[model samples]
Target chain A: MEKVLQINNLSKNYGNIRAIEDVSFEVKKGEVYGLLGPNGSGKTTTLAVIMGILNANGGSYEWFEQPFSKLSRRRIGALIETPNFYPYLTLWENLKIVAKIKDADEKDINNALGIANLLKRKHTNFGHLSLGMKQRMSLASVLIGNPEVLVLDEPTNGLDPEGFAEVRNIILSQADAGKTIIIASHILDEVEKVCSHVAILKSGDLIANGRVGELLSAEETVYIQTQKPEDLIKSLKESDLAKEVYSSDDDVAVVLNTDLNSGDLNKFCFEKGFTLTKIQVRKQSLEDQFLQLVK
Target chain B: MKKLFNLEKIKALSYPPFKTLMIIHFLLFFLVILVVSRIHFSIPGFSVKGLYQFPNIWEFFPWVASWFNIFLTIVLITLVGNEFSFKTFRQNVIDGLDRNDLIKGKLILIFTIAVYTFIMVLIAVLIFGLIFGISLLF
Candidate 1:
């Protein structure tokens, strides 16, 4: 994978408050990277800095291993926080302005509106559209120019279930097309569902950064109940497959190794003559991971 | 330059406020010309007349036009302020417009208004000078 973006030792301050400090990360091509954090954790600020909307106080960032330049910007598209179209203009007219700014062909407007499912509403004024439509319009604007990379900040913010699904689908479709994507989202579930890699931030600090599978796989938690819980716990403790095994009142739980599955646990226990009564496997949700990481 | 101007024109064409401001500017232009050209229409309360006097017409037009500058200023502020208030200024940057693009867009708008006003004022002077200026040359 080629490095598409490298943000090194980035820091930003707002008159005294540290928005983000020493934030460093690399995004590779064709990777759906998520900058996951709660509100005020500097997700918007970081994206703003990367997009050159806000200047960073310290450190450096490069797109495609090259310094930031106007030509590089033309290769990228962004949908930051909110939809900011001209209220009095029709969606078509608003898109034309965006196309002009992006230096995209006017014909691309049709494709973008089509992707947003807003072809019929092209003539409708932006103010007249619903919030969901407004979001889709912004997404459509981002799609203009066939940009190679997309930076979306809180793509699902202030959206209903339907709107959320609509935006998510559009993002997924874009990702499927092999576009490098960097999404800033406070919602762990959204990041989990869409991102292949994630970087967790808390109080503007990077806590964890890795592949989504390794960062969040609830399969690590396994619950086992047997007629002979004591023997099973002791046996699993002796086995390398089980990292942390403990027995409670009625059941025993263990944090299994990533490579080891529940089937391996059952086989190991059965070979040791421990009859299993109940075995349930559960992976860790990003919410649980986030809580533990932040703590 | 032409491409950038076309972009500005596209935005102005769609924006309702831009059209409204233009209409108001034209209306005021004609209104000022009509009122300042009437030499003997001085009412009992007002005494100043023959405002478009020749050789001083350049100075006269701006004095009459200066009265409408406040309105034009308001229009300009609203036009520029709307970009920020609507957050489109940020959008432009996000859409691959360099930050410099913003300054250029504004300069274009300012000059566009200036050029439009100057042309209107020039036409007003020519008509007024021919009809009223020579006879009441100052």
Candidate 2:
């Protein structure tokens, strides 16, 4: 697949504060790439630099393997923070201005409104809409002109469960239509659900980067208790199936490497003439894995 | 630039307070011209009447009109500030309006307002002088 975006050793500083340092990641075409980190971990700053809202202090980036330009930006839809609109203007009027700016067909306004279910409230003033509605309206702008890629920062911020579900569905539908997405999010569950790949950031540093499944599936904490504790420890140490083995109270804890089945480990220990008394496979949630990575 | 200016004009219409400010700015422009042109005073045998005359009209009109340019400045600032205060300026950039396009839009608005006010002053002074000037009738 062609590279949709590539960032190399990108860094930014705000006064004396390091906002992002040595951040590097590549987003391929048609993938939902997530920039996942806690608040103040440089997620927003990274996104701002990627969307060209802020100049990087060092390094470079490319979109579609080409230099950034208005033409390149035209093919991308983005929402950085809060929804921006004239408060006194009705929702439809706000969208009309957005459509005009985007050079999009007027008809897409209705399509976007329909998708966001804001058609009924189209005539309502933007100031009067609920926070969720305001978020949905901003999200609707992304669908205008059907841009090929979307760069969204905290796209699901301030949304209710229903609003959250709607936004996720819209993103999935966009991806289904072969549109690529780059999303910056502090919400682990949201990213885990939507992103095909993820880059984890901590304190302005890119700490982890890989496919979500690979990264999430990498940490498996397996617990096993054998009749012979010494044999269990020695066998686990000698066998490369699990690298991280320790004694936690009465049970021995071992972390299984990729594709190394707990069943296979149990069988190997049994074949070594040590019958397992208890075995437990614990899969760490994305949040747990993220916490571990951040740590 | 014209397209962007036109779009900005249309967008501004959606905000009623903006329209109100613009109306006040326009009405005040006319009112200032009218009041400045028709001033008449007499102090103990010294009389000054009809500031709207051929040469005086041309000379004094621009100066008077220039004062009212503040109205346009205020209106323009409010209009531009609305975009910044509401973060619509950033949104416009994100919506694929090259940042230069936004700057150009505001410039066109400023230009349009300046030229429009200038021409209004010219037209207003011409009518005032044509109706009451001493040059043609004297």
Model 2 C-alpha lDDT per residue in residues A179-254, reported as the tens digit of each score: 9998899999899999999999999999999999988677778888887887788888888888677776798878
Model 1 agreement with the true structure over B2-103: per-residue lDDT tens digits: 656876777676777777777887788678678655646767754344456565777788677777776668777887888889998888888877778788
Q: What share of the true interface contacts does each candidate keep?
A: 0.80, 0.74
Maximum-lDDT candidate? 1
Q: Which 10 consecutive positions of candidate 1 chain A have the poorest summed lDDT? A: A214-223
lDDT of 2 at A165: 90
Single-chain TM-score of chain A, each candidate: 0.83, 0.86
Clashing residue pairs in candidate 2 (N, C-alpha, C atoms within 3 angstroms): none
Query: What are the runs in model 2 whose C-alpha is more than 4 Å off?
Result: A223-241, A245-253, A258-279, B32-40, B43-48, B134-138
For each candidate, the DockQ is 0.65, 0.62
DockQ for model 1? 0.65
